[model samples]
Target: MSEKMQLVIDGDSVAFKQSAGFEFRLNLSEFPDLVKAHLAKVKPTANTKSTQACESLGAEVLEKDFEWEFLKPFIRDVCRWGGFALIYAKVLNEK
Candidate 1:
């Protein structure tokens, strides 16, 4: 059987699939804030505008054809308790 879980953060949901272990798949299409936060950390000098920074980073990721090594750190950080928990708890508690 396949096991999966989901948590909503900042009005957007991220899914975790369990095969051998949990694998995170983020839906950035719905969570611009998360993406922006990540970009700010990874590319601090790039842009002050969150939207623009996200777009630029998105382009870079796409240009690299979604390299896992390039994306893993960002994904790991965003999924961390300190990063997403408060947001997730707030959204979950509301429902």
Candidate 2:
């Protein structure tokens, strides 16, 4: 192939009273390894605000509640496809 490609990863994590989940979306990018959404584009597509119903939360709590069983394989595949492990992960807690 004579062409190069770029990638962007968009991730969202939401925490509820007793459960939390994360979704990551990727698209072909015009910038290399773009990992964040712009200020105007940063919004949760999921109905997390209403569901959370919490004034504040913590990463440790969300991490404890997140589904690592599914997240591990997804992270593994992303790493394999990217041919490197330059991932920045954070537990998303809201206030």
Candidate 3:
């Protein structure tokens, strides 16, 4: 649950120390930029028609790969995962 995550705030810095060493860190000065960036990336949940399209593919494709540089910052915001995501629905727009 999101409630269990550790939110570390010291002076002007903000760092979220999440489970499994996944953390999101940002300085107080970066608040405006962080808000702007992630807001631009935020998206609404997928519709039913699109969810069905994801059935054709599975998580097996990514199960064997590991990229720390990308994963490091990515894990903090990776919700819908119970610590790990071995399978996920690839939401797509209806054709």
Candidate 4:
């Protein structure tokens, strides 16, 4: 049997099963902090000043943008489908 987890965001509930070879857990309550950090890193445009600040903070502007773009579609698909099929598809495509 697979381990399952549930996450609730903004009153919407999502349940996910642990994917093969990837077993971990998340504390949903920390999601806000996670979002704050992600936003802080990715929200700014890639300017010389911003890039320097990001580098000093050990944050890579290009990398953050790339990661955000990569996850955006999956997030949209998950919200639209209300299931893990999109996630499975993404994982399958990566292999």
In order of appearance, the predictions have TM-scores of 0.27, 0.22, 0.33, 0.28
Candidate 3 residue pairs that clash = none
lDDT of each: 0.51, 0.35, 0.48, 0.46
Cα RMSD to the true fold for all candidates: 13.7, 17.7, 15.4, 13.4
Best by lDDT: 1
lDDT of 4 by residue, 1-95 (tens): 75655443334333344445443445667677987786577433322233234343333434566475555443444333333444655654563
The lDDT, on a scale of 0 to 1, for candidate 3 is: 0.48
Indicate which candidate wins on TM-score: 3
Error of 1 at 33 (Å): 18
Ten residues in sequence with the least summed lDDT for candidate 1 = 43-52
Model 3 Cα lDDT, one tens digit per residue, 45-77: 442212222222223224425354433323322
User: Model 2: which residue pairs collide?
Assistant: none
lDDT of 2 by residue, 11-58 (tens): 442222211333333344532344333323433333222112221223
* Candidate 2, position 28, lDDT: 46
lDDT of 2: 0.35
Regions more than 4 Å wrong, model 2: 1-66, 85-95
User: How do all the candidates rank in terms of TM-score, highest first?
Assistant: 3, 4, 1, 2
Candidate 3 residue spans exceeding 4 A from truth? 1-3, 41-95
Give the range where candidate 3 is weakest over 10 consecutive residues by summed lDDT: 86-95
